[model samples]
Target: MMTVNEVSRLTGVSIRALHYYDQIGLLPATGHTDSGYRLYDDTALEHLQQILLFRELEFSLKDIQRILSNSAFDREKALKQQIELLKLKRQHIEDLIALAEKTQTTGGTIMDFTAFDTQKIKDYAAQAKQQWGATPEYKEFEQKTALKTEKEVSAMGGQLMEIIAAFGKMQSMDPAAPAVQAQVKKLQDFISEHYYTCSKTILGQLGQLYTAGGAFTQNINAAGGPGTAEFASKAIEVYCRTAK
Candidate 1:
């Protein structure tokens, strides 16, 4: 485990920014020591690596969180896309360097500004973001959310958490019990009605995401108390299997 200061030095990110990232739920520390110092495990470091790469690509923090939180997110695929985008950025820099060298040789005679065009890099980065971030459900979510006032959206999110919190009350029951399954169904229907179509497949994926131990899990557990997310996931798994 590495301390926050250690991470700040290693990543060249300021301690203030690291705290801000933690505050926003963008990159939570793995744990805290008895003395209240933040500690990060290898998994947290890996997550930080992804965040830094997205930052290098000039992705907004909100966009980065949305992309990483996506249940459909594939780490390997995103890494590959980031690699391509970085290569393009490197090529763009090299082109600019060559242009500068040529202009220097010609004593500033070259008036061509084509080498400064970054449209290609911008286009590729935009395409990559769309590929990884704009899943079908996300698109649908965007459409639905675009019509709502901020207050309305916030209310909807609270309502959804209320539903998940209800699961905490039944944590002691068998996850496959009819009551638990019914609750899972209710949660699924709530998502379908408000956000996007929550088909069994999608619901199953969401179940996994809820317990995958990040912001979703954190928020869910916060609403329902500890282990609530895991219980809900198991109940969802059973519901999906029985529906199948």
Candidate 2:
């Protein structure tokens, strides 16, 4: 048996965190000392090992607690999972190390993104353009946006939220109504300003994505409840057909 402090010193975990774990019933005390201090036995040591392993793998404490509470939780099975995950992490780290070494050999500093293969850069740009669109003035746009900080993103998000709210207000209006069309134009302008130039193909694809893509629909639904994406799709499609 060992005191909580002894366990903390031996395990390198903070004493407060161990107390928290005990308070949450994750690593319950095996018995109390005469002085009312907590004591842990070998069983608790095994559980602590599992907890530490899960924490190292980035599992939330709650998730670790739930995993360990299950009667079917098997130590060997969990260890096997940990081994597989650690192997993958090791491979990822090795790849990063190779990339770093290559960069050093090529006289490329950390921020020298041009050191990356042009093909990889082109592929990423193509994917982004497909998802959004192109602005011929994008170089200028990038220059303007390069200095934007976290605070600016939060402020920009607020403006977008307002635009989206106005969009929601127009949902019950007739799709063919002049007001709805006007709102759709505003939506197009919104995307153009924040993203890039709007293309017909991208617009059509965005409409389809609202209904067909899980990620798109999930984001829309999560924002202001469900059906927002479907409504936006209809409004955009109607706008596309009628716009000059």
Candidate 3:
């Protein structure tokens, strides 16, 4: 058990915020001491983590409370999802920084494709392949695709999209439902078959990416309407927790 001050110090959340959270039924203290001092247990700490993550993602306190109070709230899965989303956001920022450097060298026109020279692109590809070839996922992908043609790869891609559409259809279902879990498993396997071994960590990262903007999010939203990506991400959360 940790005192309120301890939790505040550990999480960098202000004492006032903690009191407000408890006041609002958001992050209630798990227990109390002999002098009636608030104390937090592991579960309370976990809830606080979720609350912080949602706040970082700009979710309103009301929504975070609702989500955390939900019967199906899964702490481990939620933590993984938050970490993945933050990492993706960080990566996007890094990419923007790289592009900014390129822009500086080209007088900020930002329209010059010449910066991406053919040899540079090829070299990058070679370097990526060399680095990733050592990973189990990449080795499996390389071995599986060694004899596959471009046509077959494209066909597999279409099938994966079909499964994504199916996910949209079942967006309203509880993510822990067997039906939803099956689709998540299919998604994992399909990725492993076509691209790389879809480890749970990577799969969770992709779940976050489903709404990471660009055509991917647009297409997913078009498939099942807005919030479909969130449904898929939650489904992935369930899958990671319960998968064998």
Candidate No. with top lDDT? 1
| Poorly placed runs, candidate 1 (over 4 Å) | 144-201, 211-229, 238-244
* Model 1 C-alpha lDDT per residue in residues 8-92, reported as the tens digit of each score: 9999999998877765556766677899888887877888999999999998775687688787678899999899989988988
TM-score list, all predictions:
0.73, 0.45, 0.45
Deviation in Å, model 2, residue 78 alpha carbon:
0.9
Clashing pairs counted in every model: 0, 0, 0
lDDT of 1: 0.82
How would the candidate models be sorted by lDDT, starting from the highest?
1, 3, 2
Runs off by more than 4 Å, candidate 3: 1-136
lDDT of 3 by residue, 20-84 (tens): 76644456566678997788877678668777887875555644543453334456766665666
Winner on TM-score between 1 and 2 is 1
> Model 2 off-target regions past 4 Å?
109-244
Clashing pairs in 2: none
What lDDT does the true structure give each of the candidates? 0.82, 0.61, 0.68
> Clash pairs of candidate 3?
none
Residue range 1-244, candidate 2, lDDT tens digits: 9998999999998888877665544565666799988787776787789889878766656446535633334667778777766665666566667778987898866664433434443353344232222335444444545687534533454454345445556667777788867766776676677645656556656666656643334434434345666777787787777677
Q: For residue 5, give model 1's deviation from the true position in Å.
A: 1.8
